[model samples]
Target chain A: MMDILSEMLGYAFLVRALVVGALVSACAALLGVSLVLKRYSMIGDGLSHVGFGSLALATALHAAPLAVAIPVVIAAAFLLLRLSQSSKIKGDAAIALISTGSLAVGVVIISRTSGMNTDVCNYLFGSILAMNRIDVYLSVALAVTVLFLFILFYNKLFAITFDETFAKATGVKTGVYNMVVAFLTAITIVVGMRMMGAMLISSLIVFPALTSMRVFRKFKSVTVCSVFVSLACFFVGVVISYVYATPTGASIVIINIFAFLLFWLVRVLMTKRVAVKKPGLVLLMPLLLLAACGKSETAALPEGSAAQAAFVLEYPSQRGEAPAQAWLRQADTQGEADAATPVIEIKEKMFITQINDIYLNAGDYIGKTIKLEGIFRLEQYEGRQYRYVLRYGPGCCGNDGNAGFEVSWQPRTPAGAAPSQKAYPKQDDWVRALGTLQTYEEDGYPYVYLVLSSLSVLDTRGAEFVTQ
Target chain B: MEKDRPKDPQGIPSEPLILCKNLSLGYDGHIVLRDFDLRICAGDYCCVIGENGCGKTTLVRGLLGLISPIRGTIAFGAKIRRTEIGYLSQQEAAKQDFPAGVYEIVLSGGIGAMGLRPFYSRGEKQKAEAALMRLGMAGFRNRCFRELSGGQKRRVLIARALCAAKKLLVLDEPSAGLDPLAREEVYRLLKDVNRETGMTIVMISHDIAAVEKYATVVVTLGKEINAVGVGGEKK
Candidate 1:
């Protein structure tokens, strides 16, 4: 271990990772106790998904990913918190909804502009090796902020976490404390997301508290143990990940699980000796066993049917839009089929497979007029209307992938007279669209779409869903 | 029951610590208990008894200001701020495996008194320590809370509440899961605390025998609210 540590610390990136890892680990562990006890353990998961979406957006825009992702994820955390507080939405359900939706948004952004860049994978699976000096600095600063705030409100957090109702009665603003926890968790997730990946960042927040709880029963002891365990596991996991060439996020998560198992074994041994003293532990062990089995449920909730049916970018999902080329066509009998202009006609059999290629290699198709036969979808999202000409493709897991290219619909001749909602075909209408392939940017992320010269409803609808 | 207490000359109460007039309480737009007019005064050992789902717990919540009244007004006395009222909810109110020491839990009672100061004052610490000693929980100060017996946990919670409260302590089902001996011990502790501190207590309990034996006032609620007392005032 000494040899490995000396050699590993020689690399600047590894050193950066170690510093940030130790700091973030301690921060996550401190906040994790409150989150786990409050039954908001999955807030970490939810905030990470929101982080993924913002990172994708930042990358596509060529903006600083962390600079853009931090605020966005914080807002998302607040949103998830408020949603969970509502009587209509259950906490887990609220977490599931926001996390999956953000995941879908991320996928749509990746599918449109950058087709699964390795940077995206690092965010998904963690890459401590990729840390830069700036990331280390940011992580250090943010981690310090989190730790400072947590310490400053330690007693209040304890009061609320132990019993929110009681704490509220005593004059501690439960809402403010809860928001503080949420805000701190958001910062921790964003800073940690770079190294741990969105898929595995939640483990850093959950594993330590849980492991400490297995053997230690006092809150202060459990918290101190959690922070210590998190730091120790993080370093060990980093070393193992480097030595074994495994994903850093997975390695850390596995180490945490191992620690939890070891502590659980010790607890069981202690239980046998102290049999009559701890009935709650012995009686609740089965229930805890069920929970342990359920812990493997990492985020990756099924995409909603709306997202599944129309996985289209340029749909803006909600970052407002820029006014682009507009031509609402009844029918363009004369297509833009000049000798210089290339026209690619999509084959009916290969339509599902070909759209994927077009989206993936957008540089090749830009400025070319493409004619395709597919469904016309008019979507109303967050008070903004978007039009798409698309078809369904094979989904990973369930409804993970879909092919929908946004068709920019603006009539240039009608000067400021945007196409009325009635002018477009109804949602899910089968139509043949001929338009020039194009890309537009919003929030720095480029989105591929079609500028239609001709869009008319078709009498015959092609295959709606396809495996090809 | 204590026989040497002085009864108020008037049958009707005045200058109540907590006054509820036509108060309607519910959650998520569903009214569980409504039209509750109650007045809890100082130095009253009042026990609220009712069937399950009759809003016994809801009344406690309303009194604690955890949930606002849907229709009516719930007022506190001139000297009492909402934060000064210490509340001990039902057993399940706190997580069973909460990783806290007996002293840490008791010390947390000072959280309400700490408005903006992050750390507890020396005086507050002394108060917590005194409350712990008074409750005979000084020996369990360093012990883990989850390892304590149900009755012991109750005593620790009461001690913590004492640290927060200057005049009022609200308890919900303090004797819920205790054995007969433990139950008697809890009642005796409460009686002693009430007699010694002269602090007003509003406790929700199902033990009619204990209520008759210990409580100075009996406030029954189910179909209606009736408050009658020996040394305490009637409502």
Candidate 2:
């Protein structure tokens, strides 16, 4: 492994890849925190698509991608800024429209042109393993320029981001600053496109910021943490990709996600333990009492004390009828004694619901009965988990929007786990679940949650919950 | 308002510092202001004011040669070199997330003055630093523009504008968002520059309160020129 690594590192292309990757990662990381804070993570993704169109146009014209991509992307960025300023469309919608439209134009243009088999796929997805010396030089120069510009205009930029109206009043050229930011974002995206690809570039712009948010509070600290996390993830990802012969971009993204999960888990566990020991833990005693009513006294209470184990789901049941009860009947035999127990159910095919104040004992609920119904999203390798959202909805089936949440199952596998359901549900697939609730410590938080024992896919039309 | 005039070898009062007659400003074909006549004698502090979007900015754009007037001729006095017009646009907030320092931003002000010069020189550096010091921003010369508070940033921008101005200064909304104290400081700085150096200062501001305190002459606009005053009194 050492010999192979040494040989790989010795190659100019490999060295270039490392340098360019580091530079782009560092620059993106600096801007990523602000993007996430502003909830504009998708902007990077959109710009990447714009960069793709520019690259295609450049290739077709037999021009350097940097020369062509920079101006085009900058123009698109300005256009996007202009469009966002208009009240006719919301910012995200504008971004989506431009992103898709530009990419489509790029695809059509590429198909029409001949002899330039530029492997646009690599730019779309990323190809760090194939980086060359020119790529490194360009990336480094752009990164340095970005850093220099950012530092020079740091105060002006900060004022703009924090409050544009206020900044404008203070004699800061808010419009010019905004234009500069858009221009810089374009530069970073163009440079990074070849390594991260359009699809995953936003992840590079988001994950590091999220990880840093877990550890840092001040804006300066957030930026520092973001750069550190991004560089570390990229380096580790490159090594792993080399060792395993996986796609470099995908490997890096996966590593970032893993880091995010690790941070999230640790935070959760720490918060949970702290909450348990705090005075507030006593307030939860009543819920525990209710949960303990059915279970044995010494049945090894989960993270939540027995007194806090009771489940208090605030599901939006129509006319006070629980949707879970209806789904529970479908999971069990027709005459099961407890099948008649009141469970939450949705009478309307499409409606929003909020689940709050839910209490369960992590240990005792591990294999206990649970019936949940909502949209289901399954992660690869992880078995079917019940996904529900806390959201507001319009009459019956209209305009359902939600905050994101997911529930897991336990016993590692229930008594009758069938072949994991294929046909991964689409964006909004209505789902019902009959599962045993389980509790585990992710990071440091003790979450008492349900694990799906059985699940049924409901008709898709009623799936109105939109996740944030 | 002509005073003592220095003569060139073949001098003719060196022409009016700035001459505009029947100037018509507009966008596309729609006219905003027309048949407007104005002149700035050397070293005059001219303040232009109007209701929001009532062609104040358009006039500034015209003065800076950024926009063309539809039906007018604008002639600069021999002493009024085009490079002498130092324009400080309304404080545009920098993207705080950007990683740039104050010194670099101040340096950019020199871009106009350099006029395609390939590189910065030691003289330019000295000039930039002197400008910063003049604005009392020497201590913050190395600070990142984003890290500075609103007041500091405004001062730095003022410093930047000064760095580029050799004879004439034009500012847009120099005190739009500052607190009372910062606004006063800005006015004081403007006054000091005008008093000590006799630099021409032209500015547009919505703060009517500062008219009596700072403006040498105020030009108020409406469908036409509403009033022309000196020290807040109708002339």
Candidate 3:
């Protein structure tokens, strides 16, 4: 373990990762307390998506990601603040809209752009392992600025967070203070994005604040405790990632989750133990238990044994179910089949199959004869040629699952007879299309293609996915 | 009855300390009070009385230039500087376990006077200490604001307001949640400050009995100034 630690410390990238992680954790810990107190916990998530889009655009244009991301995130923060001010849209709704929309736009742009080696997944999730000295510097600078601002405005911030009208009446510039907070939040998201990734970044912003609040009472203590908790999580995560050779970002998030659970469990156990000594403690036991159970259930699981165990624990009945056995049915006998039916020779055509399983090495079998299922997205560019994108509607396809792929094909029928060429199937409509496999280059990137021989729409309706 | 009414102060080019003409106050566009005109003079201890949402708080806010009136001009006297206005809102129970000390909260009152400068001066610190001393909160300065009882927090907030203001003071529901002894103590403190310093005071309260006893000028607000009583004289 020491050898691995020494090796990790020797690498400049690893040092950068450690420094950036610690800085981001500190900054996030301080700001996150206010967010949690205000019940605007999702602001971090939304702003991070805005940052992701900004970074992608900057990368595509060969500009500095931080420069582009900072302004964009600040603008998004202001926009969110403005939207939240409106009586029509509540706070969470505005956050969700901006977050999802920005991420969607980011993914679409990334899909179209070339020559940019930036991985969408890494940005969405996080890549602390890939940090450089510049990233470290940015994070440190941001952390110090946030810390200074926090200290300078500590009293006013407390006053406003608790009660805005009172703060304003007492001569605090509530509007300017709020704007400063929003700006700080934007900076924190942009700085932390490299460490936490857009998706899991909010976890860093939320988890430590929540855990600290469980133990600490005062705002100052909460900020201090949250920073300590976040720093501990970051260091432990880095060390564990280095020792286990796991993804650093995931390792960090998992460490936070573990700490959260441990804190929650300790809280619950203490409350229960206290109940035995004092009956008044019994009143708090249920709340404590609920909090502990809630955190353990909600904590993001790592992509290994821990996750598998959590999945099993969540669905015990499903876990006990036996795996399906392959059937050994008898093959059709030549004597029973009126054996001498004349065989018709059919021409072998290249067909493209829908992506049934993206989790496997299905790319090698792209041009091979394979059967798959998906919905059809039809497009018209030239005469009577029905070009479509073959897609599968997975649960949370855009957010979590790699749901669909693009496919170009021509229907067998002449104009007007082929499934209303202008009327494309709505997204996530289940369909099956038989097509020949063809490799082609579009915008300087090779893609597997399927030329459709036949197509039929299945019974499944438009996109089916559960949303929280 | 019209002939017996007091003549309106018409054609007075110079502004009063607070002048509201045909003003309306409300949340959104819904009017809570209409056609309300009030004129407060320098050193006038104006106590406004009404039920919740009856525009008492709104009137106080309007006078301070925090909220714009829907349909009127709110003019302040030429001598009345904007920074001279100090306001204490209804005392909310501090989350009892908050981290900041009483001195820290009290010092926040001087933030506006300091403008955007990074640090506080020694003079500003001395003034904050003086304000706390005046409020009888000198010993509790090091104690956390969250650790104080209901009345202590009020006194601390009063110190904060004192630290902020140069001349005028506005308080909203200062006696709302306090016991009778605490409420009387607050009233006495206000009376003593006004007598000694000659500072302009405006307060919002529902305590009709107390306002009659303590207010120099009592303004009862609803659709309009229901009555403007001078000292103990009923209108």
Candidate 4:
């Protein structure tokens, strides 16, 4: 079991996956408290569908998914808020209209182009391995930011969520704060889509909050407990998927379901023990939970073994020898035809596949040099230096996976041996390194590492964690 | 000469704390009340009495700055900002399903003072606690609001409004859902708060008996401020 765990961590994709899963779940839980309490949990479902449509359109337009989905979902959220507020439509009706409409649009676009393939399935139920290096970093940064802002504005949000009219009467600027809530939720939904899938992502936002509400009544207690329970359920779900080989997104959702049920049972037992039969209180609990439950109907019900099948999903291999005809075509089109071009300029989104191909066919470019930029780090094992060029991006569903490569760096003056290079380049230093590929045998397995001839720390300007 | 006299003839400070002059109130351009004129002075327990759909609630809402006047102006006194007036909308305003403690409900009264600041200050919490104590609900601060009796909930709500109200309070149908006993308790509580604190109160109610018994001033609405009464007598 330990060997399996270590082996899973050995893959950078898995590490990135776990990091993103933790952050996304934390964010979902924190925001979920207010959403659930305010009876806006379905907004997550509604916005996720909008995100799906936006992502499908972005794919059709050949644009970045996050870049396009973020703004589009935000606009949809505002539209939902406005429609719900108007006398023409009530709450659930407005949500249903927008959610189904967006879902239909997404399905239509996907069928037209991708032909309703596994990519659509991946978007619906999540594909954990599909994440790349940049996704993990972006998720981490954004999730932390959401957490900080939520805490900072906790009182105002509480006021607005609980009693919006009173909040406005008190000068809370309920409209602006409502928009802020919607905007933040959209960002979270878009970021979480790659890992949780458009269908199952809202479950992370709804379950922990509903579950915590059952056990706790006060807003602060419910919110704080929700954060803890959300993180736990996500971590456990990721581990369960890893050990049982279940679908990542569905696994996390299953864990949340169990937590919800467990909390219900505990509350029922506690209430029975106390025998506090206050009139209408018992009937209202189920009604409130049911209201929150209806919006989550589309998430995590059917995706199990079929979801796993979709997990390993990709179009049939096009090339037998190279197996990366698409990547080669991309490299060729990017004006890298000259063999002596020294440093191949790999674009941001293409970095993962390029590194994967390079690692697989190490002998193809043994002596040739390359240059890249990423967060730098140093690790030591048995008196040998194991410096790495690390970057995290979107992998398959964000459950318990990451997409990045392990580029082991050979420092010019081995940091561990000399101890002087440590002052220059430390962990999290964004530096550009010029290096040559070196392959070696480790424990009878062929592994790829890099030997750097020149390394320079670039000025930290215009540095973005998410590459378009 | 008497016809030209101010509405209140008791010489109880003729200037009004809030004055609605020829105000027209409505929803979506449909006028409910037009050319409405009403005056509420400082420390007045003013009860707005009217038949069903006569726009008593609309007048209260307009006074609280919740609705716009279509034709005329509703002006506030120098002492009050729009946010400073305490408003307990209705018994149905705070839903029974809301998962909040009595203390939280009261604390929310001070939320207007917070503005853009993220968290409530220590002073706000103290004010909420003080409001709870003032309402004789000190021990019930931690009690779940949903589990409370209708009368208790109304008191808590009033206390919450007191936490925010510097000069005025406006309540609409506060005793609508309560039983006879609960309704009497609520009326008595409102009366006591009015007489003791000298706080201006504007209430809309169908209970004419209670209105006759407790109100310092009464205004009957029939598409306008039809009648003005002082100390239960028409001026």
Top DockQ prediction, candidate number? 1
- The collision pairs in model 3 are A350-A436, A350-A437, A351-A435, A351-A436, A351-A437, A352-A435
How many angstroms is residue A265 displaced in model 2 relative to the true structure, after the best TM-score fit? 15
Tell me the tens digit of each residue's lDDT in model 2 across A1-468. Answer: 344346447544556777888888887887777667655677788899999888888878878778898888889888887777766799889999999999998888887884224256556776653433455577799988987777666545544454444333333456777787778778888888877787777777888887866534345555766787788788777766654446678989998887777666655765678553332232232234223422432243333223222211222223333233444345444323455554433222111111221231133234545555555554443444444422233221234334223544333234222344423334344555555555555436655555554555553223243211
Point out the higher-scoring one by DockQ: 1 or 3.
1
- Kindly report the TM-score of the first chain in candidate 3: 0.58
* lDDT tens digits by residue: candidate 1, A74-117: 89989988987887788899999999999999989988987775
Model 1 stretches astray by more than 4 angstroms: A1-3, A129-132, A272-468, B1-14, B231-233
Candidate order, TM-score descending:
4, 1, 3, 2
Clash pairs (backbone) in predicted model 1: A61-A444, A218-B99, A219-B99, A219-B100, A326-A410, A327-A410
DockQ of 3: 0.17
- Residues A123-223, candidate 3: write the lDDT tens digits: 77665434334655777888789878977876567667765665666556778888888889899889888667888888888988887665444566667
Local error of candidate 1 at residue A21 (angstroms): 1.7
TM-score of the second chain of model 3 compared to its true counterpart: 0.84
Model 1: docking quality category: medium
Encode model 4's per-residue lDDT on B1-235: one tens digit a residue. 0112233347655467888788898888888888867778777788889898898887777776666788899988776677677878773445455667788778888878766676778998898998888777999988877788767887888788888876677888778767887688778877777666667788998999898777778888874466565533453
| TM-score of candidate 3 versus the correct structure, residues matched by position | 0.66
TM-score of 2: 0.50
Q: Which ten residues in a row have the lowest lDDT in candidate 2 chain A?
A: A348-357
Q: Using TM-score as the measure, which candidate wins?
A: 4
